[model samples]
Target: MKTAVILLPGLNRDRDMIAAITHISGEPPVTVWQTDTTIPDVDLIIVPGGFSYGDYLRCGAIAARMPFMKALKEKAAQGVKVIGVCNGFQILLEAGLLPGALMRNASLKFVCREVELEVSNASTAFTSGYSQGQIIRCPVAHHDGNYFVDDATLKTLQDDNRIAFRYANGTNPNGSIDNIAGILNAEGNVLGMMPHPENLIEHAHGGVDGRALFESALGLVAA
Candidate 1:
């Protein structure tokens, strides 16, 4: 399976994301620039964490308006599996690929720590390797992670079983509504999450809980 990661100007975690994906998938993913007019057609595309364009004018705002969005949106509409982590999640919301917004943390500070996330819906392509209700450790490093959606929209997300992960242990690090850590789009081909699963895919990182995400995506395409 082919995977690609987009690199945006001023993004700090592109290299880290590259290393993690290489380690987990045994192949380095292709890197594309945010300014590009087109993105490569790949089985999986990841928009990794870190401040894009220094997060100027709101998180993910500048990068969202880049010329590449049209092609990226087209592929997503065609059922390409796309996953966004941290700032990437913010971009997806800003680009209108996903609903809702990520607001500042209730604590109003950048939080960096390993947080527990329960796999709320293991049926999607992104979480198929995870068991339902399984708690996994993943690193969350972000200043804006409080997910916000209207009550009616939240209920629709719940009714459709689109909630992918929720903070475990009653630990609401960002005060996200319903403690949601991740969600899937209506078509289930896209996933957006605050925690960086790519951060914990290596043995030296103190856990391999994130490997399942890569495995599930690759396996599905292989099948």
Candidate 2:
């Protein structure tokens, strides 16, 4: 499957995401710039983590208004798979692609460490590689990663089984609601999460637990 990576100024993890996709898929992903209004035909699009525009206005607030996001929204409407990590997750919420918002870390400080994540919903296209309730290690680095949603929305997420990954093993770095580390859109084509899966997709990163996500999204498996 063809994949594309969205590039924006100040997004430091774009290369990491590109490398992970290449290493796992055996092909380099195409990169799309923030100013570009058109994107190439691809099965998946990834918005990597970083402080775009110096995280001004709020995490991902400035970057979310870019022209590229309009194209992204259009693609999502077509049912193309999209994943946004860290600040990217914030952007997804700002762009209205996903529900809820990311707030300042409950500790009010930046957090960078490995945390365990539970596969809360393994039936989705992005998570079929793992079994439900499986635990995996993933790295997270962010300041405003806390996730919050109203009771009604939270109930809907629970009812629809859209919560993808939750912080497990008592490691709620950002103090996100329900320990939510990642979530899927109502249709299951879009995903937004704070953890950095790209950083842990290889053995050199200490484990290959994160590879299944890409494999699943790329249809390398029966996902």
Candidate 3:
């Protein structure tokens, strides 16, 4: 399956994401610059993690206005699959493709370490390879990964099974409400998470738990 990865000006993880994709799918994902106004036809699109526009104004705020994001928004409306990791998740929130905002760590510090994430919803294309409530190890490195939303919206997300992942073992490193580590759109076509699955694709890096995410997407595209 063809996959496209959007690269923002300050993106740092595009190549890592590409490596993970190629490792699993045996094909290099196309890299699309943020300034590009068009998106190529692909089964999946990934907004890789990075400090887009140097995190000016706010994380992902500036990059959200890029031309390519407009095209991404349009594609999302047509049911195309999209995944956003770390800063990419922040961009998705800024772009209004997903709800809630990422705020500074509750402790007001940057956090970098392996974090345990519980798969809360495995029915989505992104998490289908994992079992619900299964715990996976992944790396999270961010100063503003705390996710916040109004209580009502949180309730809606909980009721609809949109809360796809949460910090496992009561480890809320960034003070995210209810330990939320990731979420999926109501339609389950878009997924945004704070952890870096790409960083965990190789056992040499730590573990291979992240391979499930890519495999799940490949399954969707193949289907």
lDDT of 2 by residue, 1-223 (tens): 9999999999999999999999999999999999999989999999999999999998888999999999999999999999999988999998989999999999999999999999999999999999999999999999999999999999999999999999999999988999999999999999999999899888899898899999999999862
Candidate of highest TM-score: 2
Residue 3 displacement in candidate 3 (angstroms): 0.6
Worst 10 residues of 3 by lDDT: 214-223
The residue ranges of model 3 lying beyond 4 angstroms of the native Cα positions read 220-223
What are the lDDT figures for the candidates, one per model? 0.88, 0.94, 0.91
On a 0 to 100 scale, what is the lDDT of residue 126 in model 2?
Answer: 92
TM-score winner, 1 or 2: 2
For model 3, how does the per-residue alpha-carbon lDDT over 98-167 read when each residue is reduced to its tens digit? 9999999998989999989999998888988899899999888999999999999999999999998999
By lDDT, highest first, what's the ranking?
2, 3, 1
Residue 132 shift from truth in candidate 3, angstroms: 1.1
Clashes of 1: 0
Q: For model 2, which pairs clash?
A: none
* lDDT at residue 93 of model 1 (Cα atoms): 89
Candidate 1's TM-score reads 0.96
What pairs collide in candidate 1? none
